[model samples]
Structures are given as structure tokens and as C-alpha cells.
Target: MKAVYIAKHGGPEVLTYGDRPNPEVAPGEIMLRVRASALNRLDLNLRDGKNYRGALPRVMGCDIAGEVVTISPNAHTDLKVGDRVILDNRTKCGVCESCRMGLDQNCTNGKRLGVDLDGGHAEYVTAPAANAHKFPQTMSFTEAAALPIVAHTAWHCLITQAQIRPWDDVLIQAAGSGVGSMGIQIAKMMGCRVITTAGSDWKLLKAKELGAYEGINYRTTPDLSKRVLELTGGKGVDVVFDCVGADVWEHNLKSLKPGGRLVITGVTSGTKASMDLSLLQGRPLHLMGSGGRSRRTFADMMKMVRQGSLHGVVDRVFPLDSVAEAHKVLESREYFGKLVVES
Candidate 1:
């Protein structure tokens, strides 16, 4: 099998595309012929040795959509050969206390597919039978490949953590990002008025097409909170879903109404920030962090996908051999939604 793997952590140049041994189907697992794989910021962090410190020579893709080819005899699943599916990258230890309690997101011994094990960057990949969810036939493999991480993250953050309401005024940071784009759709689906931000005016236009009620070009409007307040008629938004951390921390705080909620999932901008202690006590704000997502929430998100209410936003597609170039574009942050590589 030919795949992209990193033997030494560095830049995109460290990604080696060459022949590697085909993975064997282990018990409780299924092997699929990978059709498409999507890139995430985690891939860049792992490649540059900033987030992961594991062994080398690991395949580098987490979001996968593929066709089932082989299933271990002991695997308990309803799926069959030739079934098209998207993968849930988080593999949890079923016996863990958190897993046993139906809170698998907090599984103490969880291992991520693309991070802790070989992922779907190759022609074929193996995953736990339970992690494979059959996707609707109407969906394309490229779109399915873009759904898992970003959709799951946004769903978990907005629905499960923040508990967004229909009447709420929501603000989504970084409209051009995968999670940010998904957040806009999810918030709109719940009937919330969404205000989104992007670095460019064109990206904001794309965001508006995805249902963002208003778009703010952060490059021009450095004080994002001021515009957010004006959009909300001076009361500020009821909720804020933020992915860019420290760079927007103060702005996010100021953009929220008293007792409003703010859920943060990523920190692409630097992580350190100073918050006024007085604001927390005076405003009684609800600041929360989006942690690991569970299998249940993944299923909940898929329900929306199956109903055609939610879909993956594909920004660009690259062939398997052009994965290095895909990484370059991901790092440049020049595209909207996901960057996919077809096998």
C-alpha cells in the first residue's frame, strides 16, 4: 500500500509517500479501502512535533470515509463488505469508568486513530467496527471524509456543552474554518441568529451563503466586540462559539451579554491571554472549554447528516500523491472548510 507517513517530525517535507505493508484486520476491527481523507490542524501540529510525541512512521489522516473490504470474524457489527462509511477516529477503552458510565468522551485510555494508531491516509486502513458509521448514499466520499472531526467538534461544543437555544444570538469565530463553518450551520439549524468573523471579505460572503446572518472582517474590524454589540442592538450575543483562542479572548468576553456562554474548542492563535477577574464576577459569564467528544454525540450529529440538514463543506481536494501540497494549503489557511486527499 502507498501512503503518507512521517518518520521524523518537521515540515511538510518530512511526509514520505511510499509503499508500506498492508494492515491486517484485528479482532473487533474492520478494514476499509480508503476513498478519501481530510486534513486538520492536528495533522500539522503532529507533523511539526508540537502536539504528539509518539513513535514515528505513522499515517497522517484522522477524518476518513471508505468502503468496507474486510471485517474480522469476531467483530460484532451489522456492516458488510462494500458498505460505504465514515469513521469515528476516537477509540475508547470500553471498560473504562467513563465509558461504562456512557461518558466515553472522558475515557481515560482513549486512543485516536490518526494520532495513536495508523490512520486512513493510505489505500486501506483498519478501525474498530463500532467506529464505522454508514453514510447516506446521496453523500459523496469526499464530503463524508470531511464530516467527522469538524462536525463532531462543533456539535459537541454547541449542542452538548454550550446548550444553544433557538432564540439565542450566537457569534461564531473564524467562519472560514471547518469547525467554524459547521458551527454556523448548526447554530442556524437551531434557529439562532449567527454573526460570524473571517479574515477576508470573500470568505465572509461564503459564510453568509452557509446561513450566517452577518459577517465581520476581522482584519478591518480589530475590535470585533464593538461590531458584535452593534449587530445585537447593544445587548451583545447570547452565546459565542470560538476556535481562535487568545487572540479573540478579550473580544469574545466583551461581545457576550451578561450571563452569556462562551465555548472554546481551539487556539490557533497563541494560547496565553489575560482576562479581567472583575468581568467574571460582575458579568457572571459562563466560560467553558470543549473537551473530547463521545460516540453518542457523533451519532447525534450523523442523524442531522442523514436527514440532509448538515453536510461537509469541501474547500479543496488533492490526490493522494499531492498530500504535501495539501498540508501547505492547510498551513496557509487560504481555503474555507476542509482540505481532502483522495486515495
Candidate 2:
């Protein structure tokens, strides 16, 4: 099997594309022929040894869509050979305290596929049978590959955490990002008026096509909160779904209505920020962080996907051998939605 693995962390140059041993199906696990894998900022962080530390020679992809080729005989699953599916990268120990309490997202014994285990960047990969979910027949492998991380994150943040209402005015930061784009779609599906931000005009246009009611070019708009207030008739948004932290922290706080909710999932920008203590007491705002997503919420997201109300947005596709180039594009942040690599 040929895989893209990193033995050392530094840059895209550390990604080694070469032959590796094919993974064997372990108990309670299924081995799949990789069809497509999507890139995330986590991949870049892992590749560059930023914040994350892991073992060497780790395969580098978390968002996977593939066909089951082999299932361990002891695996208690209905999945069969040739079934197409997308995977939930997080694996939780079923007997953990949190899992026994039906809070698997908070399980103490949790391992991520692309981070803590070998992921689906190769010709084949193995994952727990419970993590695999069948995608709709109408969906392509590339589209399915794009859904796992971004869709799950956005769904968990907006629906489960923020509890977004249809009448709410929502603001989504970084419209060009995978989670940001998915957030716009999810918020719009709930009938919320969505205002989104991007670095460029074309990206803003793309965001509007995905259902954002208004788009702000943050590169030009020095005062993001002012524009958001203007868009909302000066009341500010009812909910803010932010992925870029620190850089937008103050603006996100100011752009919210009194008692509004703000859910943050990522901090691609620097993480440190100073918040006015007075604002917290005065507005009594609700601040939430998107922790690990639950299997229940993943199911909720898949239900929408199956209903055709939600779809993965694919910005570009690259071949398996061109993973380095794909990583470059991901780092450049020049594309909207997901950048996929086909096996």
C-alpha cells in the first residue's frame, strides 16, 4: 500500500509518499479501500508540529470516504464488503465512564483516527466498525470525504451547542473555510438570516451562493462589528459561529446582541486575546466552546445529509500522489470549502 505519512514534522516537505504495509483488520474494526480523503487545518498543525505531538510515520488524513473491503469476523456490524461510507474520526471506548453515561464525546479513553491512529491517506485504512456511516447514494466519494470533520464540527457547534433558532440572526466567521461554509448552510437550513465574512470578494460571493444573506470582506472592513450591526439594523446578531479565534474575539463579542450566544470551534489565528470583563457582566453573553462532538450529533448531521438538505462543498480535488500540493493549497487558504485527495 502507498501512503502519505510523516516521520518528522516541519513542513509539507516532510510528507513521504511511498509504499507501506497494508493495514490488517483488527477485532471490532473494518478495513476499507480508500476512495477519497479531505484535508483540515489539523493536518497542517500535525505536519508542522504545532500544538499536537504524536508518533512518527503517522498517515495524515482524518476526513475519509471509502469502500469496505474487509471486516473483522468478530466485529458486530451490519456493514458488508463494497459498502461506501464516511467515517467519524473519533473513536471512544464503549465502557468509559462518559460512554456509559451516554456522553461519549467526553470519554476519557478517546483516540482520533488521523491523529492518534493511522488515517485514510493511503490506498487502504482500518477503523472501528462503529465509526463508519453510509452516505447517500446520490453523493459522490469526494463529497462524502469532505463531510466528516467540517460538517460534524459545524453541526455540533451550531445545533447542539449554540441551539440556533430560525428567527435568530447569525454571523459565521471565515466563510471560505470548510466549517465556516458548512455553518452558513446549516444556519440557513434552520431559516436564520446569516451574515458571513471572508478575506476576498469572490469568496464572499461563493458564501452567498451557499445561503449567506450578506457577506463582509474582513480584509477591507476594519470594524467588523460595525458592519454586522448595520446588517442587523443595529441590534447585532443573535448567534455567532466563530472558527477564527483571538483575531476576531473582540469583534465577535461586540457583534452579538445582548445575551447572545457565541460558539467557537477553532483558533487558526493566534489564540491569546484580552476580553473586557465588563462586557461579560453587562451583556451577560453566553460563550461556548465546541469540544469533542458526540455520536448522537453525528447521526443528526447524517440525517440531514441523507435528506438532501445538507451537502458537502468541494472546492478542488487532487490525486493521492499530489498530497503535498494539496497541503500547500490548504495552508494557502486560497480555496473555499474542502480540498480532497482521491486514492
Candidate 3:
């Protein structure tokens, strides 16, 4: 099978596209003929030597949409060969206490695809059949592949961690990002007033098209907190959804109302930041760092996708062989939504 593998973590130039042995079918697993896989910030980080724990010569991709080629006899899923599906990518021990309690994301033995195992940056990949979700018949493979990682993470951060309520004022940073754009849509669906930031007017306008009520061009207004305060009539937003990390940490803290919450899912920007202790001392605030979602939460997100209530925004599609180019596009941070690769 032809695949892209990283022998050493450094840059896109390290990605090698060549033949790799086909994965064997394991009990309780399904072999998929890869159709499309979407790029995420995680992929960039893995390539750039951050948050990655896997060894070299690893296949790296998470958001996968494919057709079932074979189902292991030991698997109990209702899916069959030729069925179209999306990979969950969150590996968990189903019998673990956390998993039984619907907190699979907290499972003591949980592992993530691409990071912990070979992922979908190839012509073929294997996944636990139980982790595969039926794809919406209405969506193309590229669109289906774009939904899993970003959509689930956004839903988990906003609905699960933030516990957003209708009429709340929400602030989403980096509106053009996959998760950021999805966060804006999810918050809007819950009837919240959304204020999102982007580096360019084009992206800000695109964000509004996706449902954000106000767009802040961070390039023009570096300290977005001041503008956010002005937008909220100086009261600050009820929730600040941030993934940009340190670069906007202070701004995120300041843009929130007293007792408001800040839900963080990723740190795309530099991770370190300096802060004054008195900032939080003056006003009570809640800070939440959310990770992967449980199987139940992913199912809920799928329901929304099927019902057309939530949708992924695909900015471009690249062939699997052009994996390097895909990383370049993601690192450039110019795309307004998800970028996909078709195998």
C-alpha cells in the first residue's frame, strides 16, 4: 500500500510517500479503503515535534472517511463490507470504568490515532469496528472526513465543558480555523451571540457567513480584549472559547465576564504566557481544558451532522501523494476551514 510516513519529526520534507505493508485485519477491527482524510493542527504539531508521543516511521492523520473493505469476524459492529464510515480515532478500553461511565476520553488506556497508532495517511488503514460511525449518505467522502476531529472537539469544548446556555455571549478565537469555525456554528445553534477573531477581514467575513455576529480582525486589534469588552458593552462575554493558547491567554481571560468560563481545546499558538496574579483575584473565573470526546458525545455530534444542523466547511482538497503540500497549507493558516486529502 502507498502511504506517507514520518521517519523523523522535523518538517514537511521529512514526510515520505512510498509503499508500506498493508495492515493485517485484527479481531474486532475493520479494514478500510481510505477515501479521504482531513488535516488538523495536531498533524502539524506531530510533524513539528510537539505533543507527539509516537516513534518514527509513523503514519499521521486522524479525520478519516472510508469504505469498509473487510470486517474482522470477532467484531460485533452491525456495519458490513462496502459500508461507508468515518473513523472515531479515539481508542479506548470499552470495559474501563471511565468508558463504562461514558467518559471514554478519560479512559486510563485511551490512545489517539496518528499519535498513538498508524492513522489514515495511506491507501488503507484499520480501526476498531466499534470506533467507526456510519457516514451520512448525503455527504461526499471529503466532507465526511472533515467532520470527526474538529467537529467533535468543538462540540466537546462548547457544549460539554463550557455548558453553554442559550443567550450567552461567546467569544471564539481564530475563527478561520477548523475547530474555531465549527465552534462558532455550534454556539450559534445553541442561540448564543458569537464574537470571533481572525487575522484577516476575508476570514472574518467568512466567519460571519458561518454565523458569527461580530468579527474582530486581530491583526488590526492585537489586544482583542478591549474590542471584545466594547462589543459586550463592557460586561465581557459569558464564555470564551480559545485554542490559540498563550498568544491570546491574557486577552481570553480579560474578555470574559466575572464568573464566566474559558474552554480551551488546543494551543496552536505558542504555549507559554506571563500573567498577573491579580487579574483572576479581582474576578472569579472558570478555566476548562477539554480534550477528546466520549463515544456518546461523538454520536450526538453525528446526529447533528445527519440532520444538517451541523456541517463541516471544506476549504480545499489535495491528493494523498501531496501530503507535504497539505501540511504547508495548514501551517500557512490561510485556509478558512478544513483541508482534505483523498487517497
Per-residue lDDT of 99 in model 2: 99
> Sorted by lDDT, highest first, which candidate order results?
1, 2, 3
Q: Which 10-residue window in model 1 sums to the lowest lDDT?
A: 48-57
TM-score of each: 0.99, 0.99, 0.96
The number of the candidate with the highest lDDT is 1
How big is the positional error of residue 64 in model 3, measured in Å on the Cα after superposition? 0.2
What TM-score number comes out for model 1? 0.99
Clashes of each: 0, 0, 0
lDDT of 3 by residue, 81-164 (tens): 999999999888888898788778889898877777889989999989988998678889999998998899999999999999
Question: In candidate 1, residue 76 scores what lDDT?
Answer: 98
Candidate 2 lDDT: 0.95
Clashing pairs in 1: none
Off by over 4 Å in 1: none
Off by over 4 Å in 3: none
Candidates 1 and 2 compared by lDDT, better number? 1
